[model samples]
Target: MLTYTPAVQHAQPPASERPWLLLLLAFVWLWPGVFAHDLWAPMEPQLLTVIEQWRNGGHWALPTLFDRPYWEAAPVYVWLGAASQAVFSPWLLDAYEAVRLVNVGLMAIGFCCIGGAARQFLGRRFGRTAVLVLIGCPGLLMPAHLMSTIPLLFTGAAMCFYGLSLAKARVIMASLMLGGGWVLLALSGSLLLSLSLMLLGACLPLSPHWRYRRYYLVLPTALLWAWPQMLLWPYALYQADTAAFFSWWQQQALMPFGGFGQIQFDFSLWYYLKNLLWFAFPAWPLAIWSASRLRLADSDWGILGMAWLALLGFLLAVSPLQFQDLLVILLPPLAVFGAAKLDALRRGAAAFLNWFGIMTFGLLALFLWLGFAAMNYGWPLKLAERAVYFSPYYQTDVDYFPILVACVFTPLWLWAITRQHVRGRQAVTNWAAGITLSWSLLLTLFLPWLDAAKSQRPVVQQMQKAFDADAVRRLQAGQECVSVEAGNHTARIAWQQYGWLTLDVDNPHCRYRLVRRSPQATTPAAGWQELWAGARPREKREWLALWQRLPAKPTEPAKTLQ
Candidate 1:
């Protein structure tokens, strides 16, 4: 039998390359994609809407969108975002931008906790490698930068890992982390995940490696710490409004389990497995190699990591899978497990990863540059035409600052990659650098174009123009409210934010109504006249149309009385 060796036995890097330096690099990697852009569609706007509602004196216990209770998740993340916005939006940032800062903080916490876990499990030096593996994950990049609860969820999971790693030696600290992580997972709108972690903690004693006297205190201590926090929000919400509480309970707690029965036994069950190919990437390959070499009983941390991965994988398999559902939970365990065996990685594999990152990102960055040139200069006629095809209304203007930034980073990336040696940690570092460089280039070079395509500001602006023209015809002044019919939450929020229009979906008496429809769909339903029709520049199918209620024909004079 092949014997397993602790990762601490491997040669360590110089003191100059410390975990703090890796964290600093991670901070740099996190900021660019976050700061420069407006909230992009599908999720960011929805989160902002919830925060806006809360800020506008909506009840803290129940999160509402356009005055309707939204019970998809708990309001913990929304509350945090509201506080962040309140603190920062006054002077430093826009509302959405301010909320996004929470993402940065959550990711920072996640990095630290995961690094701490790695240090406990593998060795002191392996912490940096674990963090690098996480930073390099393609799955983490977009979600981490967005205004979503997933980052909080990721942080919570990282805390659980860190707490689990500390169970044998630091019982009190481990219990607190475990319990606190459970609360975070619950509050972040995933009760199921919180429960899973709790169960995982309870089962730890069953493992031969973790059957120590101190380990038994972990779960009960975690539970004692967690129960009050877990109940506090729900109980307050219930006391505030029973109906809304039940709605939230049904959706948040009961619905996840109910959803499993609804899932068909189809190819969709393999969703995480399929996406793991690109989502987990470098980490998954390394984790598989590590797992292959080590027995389940080899290390307590290894057992815990594997169990956590399996539990999450099973949960994801049975439950419905959306793009955002994968979050950062899956990556940290993989990183911990993978980082342990970094030195054991064969030379050819390390070199391949290094070159693969270089070649892939090198070409991608080159293409992104070309696309930017096409957007600004129309130098490459074909690519320029494609750009125009996507965003017809987007005008060509050179933003020299982003261009300069991208210009500097491109050569810097080339320099960094060329100088790096093909060692295990170096390979992972190269991958992380490549991801950061590519994402930075996209956010910098293509930000304007991306914003043009994704932002609802332009769409709302067009609707505003039409509404203004109609308002002028009616000789109305000041802001006028409009009722929305069939308009999505995104459009409703966008109208209020950009167009400064008060939207009441429940108001039947409002004169104007906004309707959303596919481009191929027929006219608005009877009694409303279409005033304006438009969609985002890149939106090919769906469009929003502004309509005014046709004035009720004056009742015919009472001829019968005459």
Candidate 2:
């Protein structure tokens, strides 16, 4: 017997690594109530109304906002919202809650896709790391929870990559993914062009079984059913509407593909980087490092991810990228790039990351908690004052339910901190755990305040009340409804909120009129008596002007109001 030393196998990992449980717990922590917060200004309300119009009309093609076709091409979320609204309409107070829950579900699915793909390419250790990169980014917080196209776009990007990963091994699944993923991308408003371009990018990165992929791609193309089958939501405008469409599109995509035009776009390269500096966070720094070592990264997935990064950059550079657009361009590839180098994290990097996460999120949680305590318990004098000043109308309510939920989750997050075995000893462990805590506390403890400050309800109510204490009564008594023009997105939101009291959406000569701009800057062509004017102080641009017609002049037509 040659030294029969009993080879002791290291203690086996748990029977179930419990991927589903971890993912679910993460979601539970990060995912807030759909109706817990308000539809924020700038994007949320505008997008909300677009979806509302879609569901209200029951037509498939994207509806026009104000009068022009929205042409966002982000129909997946709208369709999902419509479907969920159909199911939850009778019961739910806010149909957006259903749409929101669907968002959470899709979000969870996207996490699964990221983890699954990471497990295959980068191995089990980095699969969890991928999730950390996603949630830890501070920028993702608002965008992640928002009722906008970004959620689906982010999730779809993950699916597109995962589908690419499965292309070789699971041809049927790959075809389904490629087809379905591209369609979802196209449906995500104004991304159809991006979709077609990315498809070409996907093709350039060749792996084995190249011949089989052509067939895979072909099959999915059929499933797209671009024009004919899309009649369910057939929302495109006619050739006559081309001028308006291009005009709107031009605003967002300034000097787009500028090489084709004499108008050379600077691309705001520095500005884009500045935004990414904080928005992209550790992933941005880590991605830069990973990009430096691309040659040494895992063979196929690394290159494929790099290709995506290149494409996204090209698009962002060429187009006038909005801040929201970063969710699509920077994040997904950052996760991939970060995941590729997970195992290679030096002890120093790990320690830095651990401390960075611990501080960034830990302080965030503390500040949020302080704010909550200040509001509910009136502990901190200064913080409480600020909170009150910001949202004076936000009354404190001791809601037992969210408090109870927070009590459970607060300890759960603390437990997670100690339970290293649960998520593993990866560098990203602390960041993920910290973010989850921050999300949980913010949603549960600080939600009421957020709803007060952010929701359009108070703003709309105040504006209405300012007009007259019984303005609603006057409108309800079959009197003239207020005249509202489809102004900018901000005013459109107010218009939608106050639409019920309106005499007619198209009416201009109506006695009571709602003008978006200040009365002094531009008054009605027919002189008007300014009834009441106020604005949500939070947004300087939103100046709500309510006017009563002085007298009608023959020269002032409804079109003149334009």
Every candidate's lDDT? 0.79, 0.64
How do all models score by TM-score?
0.90, 0.81
Writing each residue's lDDT as its tens digit, candidate 2 over 381-460 gives 89998888887768886788887977776666565555443322344666766777778788888888877877767767
lDDT of 1 by residue, 447-494 (tens): 888887888788877777764565854524434557776437767777
Worst 10 residues of 2 by lDDT: 252-261
RMSD of 1: 5.0
Deviation of model 2 at 397, angstroms: 2.6
Q: Which stretches of candidate 1 lie over 4 Å from their true place?
A: 1-21, 258-268, 467-470, 473-481, 504-511, 549-562
Instruction: For candidate 1, give the lDDT of residue 478.
Output: 36
